[model samples]
Target: MSRRTFSVVVLDSLLSLATKLQSGPMPEPRVRTAGATRGRLWRILMVAGVLAALGGAALVVTVLIRTPEGSAGRPETAAGLPGPPIPPAGTDAVEPSAVPTTRPVPTLTLPSSVATSASSRPPTTSPSAGRGSSTPESAVVPLTARYTTSSVTAGLLGYHLDVTITNPAPRAHTDWRLVVTLPRSTLSVSGVSGATATQDGAAWTFTPDDTTSRVAPRASVTVSFNVNGATLLNAAPTDCQIDNTPCTT
Candidate 1:
């Protein structure tokens, strides 16, 4: 039974017994029997004992129901229950977020001077020497030179003649000579650089200098001099030869 209900029943029983005892006339000292007296006293003592036991039991039950298990006088949760266990401070329950991936940076750099020289230079092709009727018709001349003339005036005197010789051959020429003949015989000639210059009156011949190495293919060398005391005529050199073969200027 509920604590309130039990308490009310005990209170009502005590009040009723008190009222009966208080209202009933004093048991006549002469008329009252010993057995009856004993019986009445026993009844009162039994009722008091029963009330005390029931009240104590009601208090115990109330305390047990009102106080939660394991609470130990502490405050309870919203649902009147304990909370779930939490992870430790350094626990792995929470993982770090993944780092964002980054693309590598591209670089744009200019080529070095040496690299530029190497790559910018034209590629060389091997030459086919020795004449052969069996050779392909598309075969090109092994050696060739390009000639251009530039004149510098010396006022009333002759002009300066500049000769530029180029080797278009695919292979290097170890020993080479350039021969040029002038139509007029009056002009004087000086020696040339990068080559030894010799003149036989109007005929001029230039040979590679002993100190110089072989002439590289596709290389150009220039020789120039001032021609004085005569008006230079026919600046173009004729009958030019490279190595042993006649070269097309």
Candidate 2:
């Protein structure tokens, strides 16, 4: 062989060897890339599994918490615990006849006297003056008087009399003399004498010179007088007056 052809063949052989080395597989780089890709996929799958397990555990807890006990319909006692008691039947009720009844009581009343009075003298003259004497205008005059009976029993033997006398004048009345004449049908006088009498002739007067009577202005006098029951029952008066003028009955 020629020397130049041999040199050319050796150089061509070296260049072909270099090209084959470069084209061959690199195991370290390929392995590293594959492992990194697999690791990322595994981490993603692990995260998904953890989220699903947490969601399932939460749903289970919610169901358990919402459930209620089965024995909630029982009755409770005052002590806050369950109890059983049988109520009384209709036979235990009370009947109308078992109740008690009450009665009303009546009240009684007795007879009482309403009013009484007495008087003496002529209708127009003062009892202190004689029949022909001239009387001053300011002198107190004594005149015929009357009395009335009230609230008296028809046939009562004894009773009480409430006498009220009112003074109408502005001045206080320091003395009063009253003579009460009883009817002949009810009372009888024992003493017999010729007495001074007025023209009316229906009544008599007995004046006692020892006692004095008086009344105050704009005031009233209430007195309890005692008289014979038989006389008053038979000789009840119908009218009352003071000094020949009509007074309260």
Candidate 3:
């Protein structure tokens, strides 16, 4: 039964017992009034004892029902009876709420133009790769010389000719030579500079010296000589060549 109902029943039984004792049936008039008195007192004491016993039993049962099992007298909260448990502060207790530790990293997207440029870019290669002693077909040597003559003020010389050699290749030419086939009947030549001159018949070959040995890319070198003989006013050297390539004046 509910605690309230149980308590009311017990209280009602105790009240009824007290009322009966206060107004008991009139005892029969007997000659020994002392015997009647002792008997009445004994009955009242017996009823009191029974009431005390019942009260004690009710208290015990109420405690047993109210107390939760295995709670050896911990503090009780009086919400009519006592048994809700609160978790203690420790790692063993389950967490009510927690943040997730692992998540996927956010991806940053590039613009379409940037992505296309990156993907379409060519990969770089080493400059020395596939290159050796042989020059590639595109790197041909374009060597030429311009022969111009000026009349010498001194009568001893017929002409002062300047042979300017030009190198148009991308790289320097370490070795180069200029061969000039002079006009027939040309007198002995002199005042040559910038080269070691050698002649075979009408041809005069000029091999570059240390100073002019290396012709830098897109650069020029000049060798001049004086010819002391008859020649046309606009005469230029014949069979002229720098290295093996013929250089037309």
On TM-score, the candidate that comes out on top is 3
Against the true structure, candidate 3 has what lDDT? 0.74
lDDT of 3 by residue, 101-158 (tens): 9988999999999999999999996557666545664666778877777775544447
In order of appearance, the predictions have TM-scores of: 0.36, 0.28, 0.41
Clashes of each: 0, 3, 0
**Mind giving the per-residue lDDT tens digits that candidate 1 earns over 111-167?**
698789999999996556674444454454354444444455623465555556665
Residue 211 displacement (Å), model 2: 9.4
Query: Which portions of model 1 show Cα errors greater than 4 Å?
Result: 1-141, 210-213, 232-239, 243-249
Could you give the candidate ranking by TM-score, starting with the highest?
3, 1, 2
lDDT of each: 0.61, 0.46, 0.74
Lowest summed-lDDT stretch of 10 residues in model 1?
Answer: 132-141
Cα error, candidate 1, residue 119 (Å): 49
Clashing pairs in 3: none
Best by lDDT: 3
